[model samples]
Target chain A: MSPSKSPLIAVVDYGLGNLRSVSKALELTGAEVIVSSKPKDLLSASGVVFPGVGAFYRGMENLRERKLNSALFKIIKEGKPFLGICLGLQLLFTFSWEHGDTKGLDIIEGRVKRFEGNVKVPHMGWNQVKQTQDSSPKTKDLFQGIPDNSYFYFVHSYFVVPKDKSLIAATTEYGGEFTSCVCKENIFGVQFHPEKSGPLGLQILKNFIDIINDSQT
Target chain B: MFSKRIIPCLDVKDGRVVKGINFVNLRDAGSPTEQAKVYSNENADELVFLDITASSDHRKTMLEVVKATAEQVFIPFTVGGGIRNIEDIRTLLHAGADKVSINTAAVENPKLVKDASWEFGSQCIVVAIDAKRKKSVTSNQNPEWEVYTYGGRKPTGIDVVEWAREVESLGAGEILLTSMDRDGTKEGYDLELTRSVSEAVNIPVIASGGVGKLEHLYDGLTLGKADAVLAASIFHYGEYSIKQTKQYLKDKGIPIRL
Candidate 1:
């Protein structure tokens, strides 16, 4: 495929609400965005952004129904940049216990577990995220120009525990340290909503756009 | 670490701002989308657009405002006031509202809270509770708060604490607790009412109404044990910028993003 002047980013629309904010944020970062539920549209894009908010089982069910599962697999296998947000991030893991034992895409080996003990269930609002020291150099580039401990808007009940420790890009302290960001090869996932996270969050999206632009060259 | 949030609330009517915004650089001050852009640029953690429009026909105007704001502003925002059913919530969420708050509707139909949270995620469903101190309490009895409906006009006679617990159990992710007595008086938040409901629920509680000064904001987060504070007048009157408020909270040893 010939490299276009502007990278077209496909935001996977697997029957979830609130894709407007995600697509709008990406558009502001100078990337052409197409909120598409069609699998072929996702495969043709330079980068794919999988964003959703809801139950893990419902999200996977929609993906399978829309045939987005195979498109996502192809995007990752073909080395296209993939960014996942919130439930989009959780769906990349092995499985989740959200409504029951639900299987995920297994792109990353991990279990989506609930927040237990005395802390709040959803873990809503702003929290500081520190980049893990073991993050790879390319993963560190994801946080480029973003200050450490910047606050991001997060609203989630479950957290991911990646089996491969190297995939952990950042950790945040809720009751204890849980993986907030994960990066491996061309895949990146964040538990927080970067679209809703203000400037620093926009910077993360800008960085992803930059990565896509660089790869196209 | 979780930072206590300082959210600025805007009263929008018929897709325009009802309250005066004291910010200097606004091109169109009355436009809700423009004001939202200014607030988001001022480092506001989040925004709440309370549509006080009386007629249900004006909801389409509010949806346009939400769509415009979502297109321009990057921060998270919640739209409340006059939301009645699941269809109303779905439209706002689809139009780019990160969350939709239900007050009178949630009180009237408790099952709406359960069904809405079940359909959309609980994280996007915020149940706003307007509570007033129950009158005629004897000296021997502990002071209690009664839930008010229809924008704090009618008393529901329901215990504020019990209502908060019920909504949380019904799958509310957060509670926007507003004290009616202290709303316009500006003395301070009813710390007792706030703490009781905050301590009773496992979800995050946002203390609303009666923030006269920076100290009042500090007290609400500390003594009231609230996860966030929502104020309209203080930020509107140019009394303090969001950065100044966060700085004060941070100095008071409260965990806030600077």
Candidate 2:
């Protein structure tokens, strides 16, 4: 077992953050974890984890308020291993129609839309996430130890619709097939809360840390 | 597909899960952390820790338990009992509780729900309602479920269905609907009450209490139309593992994580 020399993963604390659980899981992956909202801390860190639970507009507003938005973009542009959860995943898209027209970070090309139809909004509970491709980068990197049709805890109404289908690392069918995970090289986004998804979730975090270790050596 | 959730509720008293019979009896099930670790691995959708004896010191102990569980178990869990204000919710959430359920406080001061939801999104604010069913004489419809608070010791004279709508409107992400009459009896869930509340609100309603058998879970999901089902004794006593319950639901053609 690797004894904490694993990588410094700065879990961005944007006020509305899931820091404790995320850091706990990250540390279990043997990575040194830091919860910081400052840009400098994120710059020095090996990886950044953006875990949020809130409305998309408010989340974006918070990132902007804390000036962490620019820091996030800097980290991502540098090709640092980035993992986004829930609202963090939704913020990666182009825009969301959550309450009204709200612009996102636009890192990934997609429109965040709410779950329409008779299927309930704020789709909460343990749902299955199927890997879109057998050997995609996200599959090789994130889903390394995770199996197909694995269940991850999800509690969100809005789902991302990335324009590029291949970017969809995984898909979970709530009312219909929506992108549950979006992966483009170093950038990985999961609509589910991995920090709260049990062993399968821990495995996903472990896989992310492994990606960090690989990039280092 | 969105699988129906099967939640196991842990009644925490003095940092240990105790039996449901009485509060003072204190038949220790196990450490909250260990039991949570077991359930996390068991593929349980979620876990709820109700602070039975919610003292100030007890709250601190529960926070430690929550931290320990968060370190070990990666799945989502909620903390309830004696959550009087937004500060309590904030402290619990910071300590790694995914969601915080407010029963007594929420009823006494409905603003707590709105305020908590405003501070920390509705997704994390779970308002637990312990409701008792009363036969409706004037209305020819079904019986009326009355809201009971203070751990089911006090009746608020509030309608269960109406209160559910109020909470949802106040930004409660979900409603933990517990049937007091059906609780611990193991007969089954209050399907009529469950269906009424489920139909009343747009937010997700979790049907809690009264779950004796595996079929009760199915009934909560199908017949009761609840988004999720919460049980305590069935899982705690080893009567059935989360695996057995999930398998039962899956066999019954309900979407569940195997």
Candidate 3:
């Protein structure tokens, strides 16, 4: 695929997110990116990404205010690939109990809950992720050719528990078994920050870009 | 699992690696790029280049040396000394440095730590502290050590442990603590100093200065609770190799990359 035809990945910047690092990582994979807060830019892109770092409620509220809620739903329903990272993943769940009872995107039938275990709250540093479901090209496409238990960087205080077990693409042992990654049809999310996961993280992004490029061919 | 790291630090002056006996009587080791390539071949996890001179003429020369060394060495490297502003950090990082270590500048202007962390992320900012034992003069004097700046030339008069906690809160990703008393002594790391600073901050602590043998590396990790061990004279003078040090640590059941 030509560089221009390769899907322009839209990294949504809703005024509060770590978009620079994510954008730089994607750019390293030879993917053209447009970091935009405009609904038109997000809707026109081939792939949409919801990248966030802070509270889920604030993120969802920003998206709704910008009319990106309808734009994202329309794009996802169109069967185009979508990736959610960290808070972006939490926003996909039905609701979150972070500061109060806050509703999420409800795209996936899951609830985001605070970490309740003996392990540390942030779950910082490097940790291993074990693959559970083999569906979705992201399973082998994103994590392709890597070791079964390759370590990825993680920094979070909450995790998602999908109501449907089929959506759980990977699980990791933090305090216990917790969903580290999830995928459903064209929608996918990772609890950990892949951009900061070092070489393994870079490979996952490369795979995602390759899949996007292949779709055009 | 994350493997433990072994690092070698080179004190550079006028674009050349220099080693001093007891922090004085400096002698040129070799070209910075040549020495860095040798360490890279030996499987050193990371390398630290500290510019020991304070000359403006030498700083530009060192920048060129860093660019050349970074071109040859692929492993993560940190450059320190006389970094006063964000532009200096940006220049070094653009020249292929994975991280930048700030000492005197960070202490002089604490806000620089936050600014650098914001600009290049927390993982790229490392704070280096030179600590020395303070003799108790009066009953009211604090028991903690004192912090020094300007290549250990001037005393900052700040409590070492307190300053470590403050810097970490200011957004330093890691702390490279060197014991001025034990440096170049080839005895062992100052476990008391290392343990004190490691316990003071949440970030990783790299123990530098006195690392004479393999046991010293293990001592830093196990006893001192250091995230990484840094040596100079032993590695620079060819007394020990990075591979040998890592092998010893691995054999001792310590988590290290071989």
Per-residue lDDT, model 1, residue A216, is 76
Q: lDDT order of candidates, best first?
A: 1, 2, 3
**DockQ, candidate 2, vs. native dimer:** 0.77
Worst lDDT 10-window in candidate 1 chain B:
B134-143
Q: Once superposed on the true structure, which residue ranges of model 1 sit more than 4 Å away at CA?
A: A1-4
Candidate 2 residue-wise lDDT, A1-217, digit = tens: 2233679999999988558889988898778999998999999999889889888988988999999878888999999999989998889989999889999999988899988887766788888888877547655778987888988899987889999887888888877888889888899999998888887888899989988877776
State the lDDT of candidate 2 residue by residue for B136-184, as single tens digits: 6457766887999887899888999999999999999999999999998
Clashes of 1: 0
Chain B TM-score, all predictions listed: 0.98, 0.94, 0.91
- Top-TM-score structure, candidate number: 1
Where's the lowest-lDDT run of ten residues in candidate 1 chain A?
A1-10
lDDT-better candidate, 2 vs 3: 2
Please identify which of the two predictions, 1 or 3, would achieve the higher TM-score against the true structure.
1
Give the clashing residue pairs of candidate 3, or none.
Answer: none
lDDT of 3 by residue, B1-258 (tens): 445668889888887677632321223336777777667666676789988876876788877876676545545678998899999988877665657899999999999999887666566688999998887746586446799998899998998899989988887778999999888788899997898898777777899878878898899998998877888888777677788888889899986655
Strongest candidate by lDDT: 1
State the lDDT of candidate 3 residue by residue for A93-138, as single tens digits: 8999876879988999989887775543444445678887455665
